[model samples]
Target: MLADYIHFMKDDFWFIVPALWFIGYACKRTPFIPDWLIVWILLCIGVLASCFFYGWSVRAIADGVIATGIAVFSHQIVKQTSARDQIE
Candidate 1:
């Protein structure tokens, strides 16, 4: 299971993950857009961008969603941990 995940990360999701992270982080800084809308827009961009590589297949879309989720999860982990540490 671990190997499979590593393979997926190396072959499919490496670039998309970081790119989406940066996009989301940048979007979060914009005050004009509501926070709720930022994530949805970022996910859509990730999915659409993946289509360029996978040519509109289900796999492409799935990979995009997974990558985006991973990026968001990682961001939240860092954010929450840092906040908790600061409180101490």
Candidate 2:
């Protein structure tokens, strides 16, 4: 899973993950947006941003999705770790 994401990801766009992470955090804190929609919102932004950088193409879209996945997956890992620590 990790390898696949890495293979599809573009090294030049390293900033995208962090950018999406912060954006995701912002969306998470906002009361109006439902939790379920955050991923979709991130996906749209990620894809568009990457497309802007690499030009519109299938590879760009894949890279964007991979970046977004990494961002979201890392966030969940941290949150889960904290929650587990608190529970134990």
Per-residue CA lDDT of candidate 1, range 1-41, in tens? 22445455337557887888888878889888888887788
lDDT of each: 0.76, 0.91
Each candidate's clash count: 0, 0
- The worst-scoring run of ten residues by lDDT in candidate 2 lies at 1-10
Q: Candidate 2 versus the native: TM-score?
A: 0.89
Using TM-score as the measure, the top candidate is 2
The sequence of per-residue lDDT tens digits that candidate 2 reaches over residues 1-88 is: 5566776677899799999999999999999999999999999999999999999999899888888999899898889988996877
lDDT of the structure predicted as candidate 1:
0.76
lDDT score, candidate 2, position 25: 91
Model 1 regions more than 4 Å off: 1-12, 86-88
